[model samples]
Target: MVTSIILMNVERSKINEVAQQLADTEGVSEVFSVSGTYDLVAICRVPTNDDLSELVTRGLLTIDAILKTETMLAFKAFSRHDLETMFTIGLDGI
Candidate 1:
């Protein structure tokens, strides 16, 4: 999967509305209203780079309340759960 983390600066009045809209979008997995430089953060996962591009350009950027956005493409994913699972793979047979 192609995962993208999108940081968005939205019009203050429309933050909640925009977040809900983003959450309902097809490729967007989650939307968070955060406290920082950006008002919202959206996690998007798609099948290919072309799908990512279409989601960002056509799906997200089209929102009028979104003042600005920065999209980051994930190269790799690491999680404590995954690591633990990997290390314990053969333990169940013991």
Candidate 2:
């Protein structure tokens, strides 16, 4: 899976509406209103790079209300699967 974190500069009043729209998008998993240079942030997941690109090109960039965006592709994550499978408990005499 490919995941991206998008930071956006959105109009203050439109922040909520825009965030909801992003959250509802098929590839977007979550959205948050943040206090920073950017008004909103979104976490999105897609099957491939192409889908991620499509979402940025078609889903996000196409909107005028979205003044700007910065996208970061996730390289790592913490989860039960990663923790249990990657770490091994010592089996030798202790």
* Best of the candidates, lDDT: 1
Clashes of 2: 0
For model 2, what is the C-alpha lDDT against the true structure? 0.85
Per-prediction TM-score: 0.83, 0.79
Poorest lDDT segment (10 consecutive residues) of candidate 1: 79-88
TM for candidate 1 is 0.83
Model 2 residue 3 lDDT score: 88
Error of 2 at 36 (Å): 1.1
RMSD (CA, Å), candidate 2 to true, equals: 7.3
lDDT of 2 by residue, 44-69 (tens): 98999999999998989656688889
- Each candidate's number of clashing pairs is 0, 0
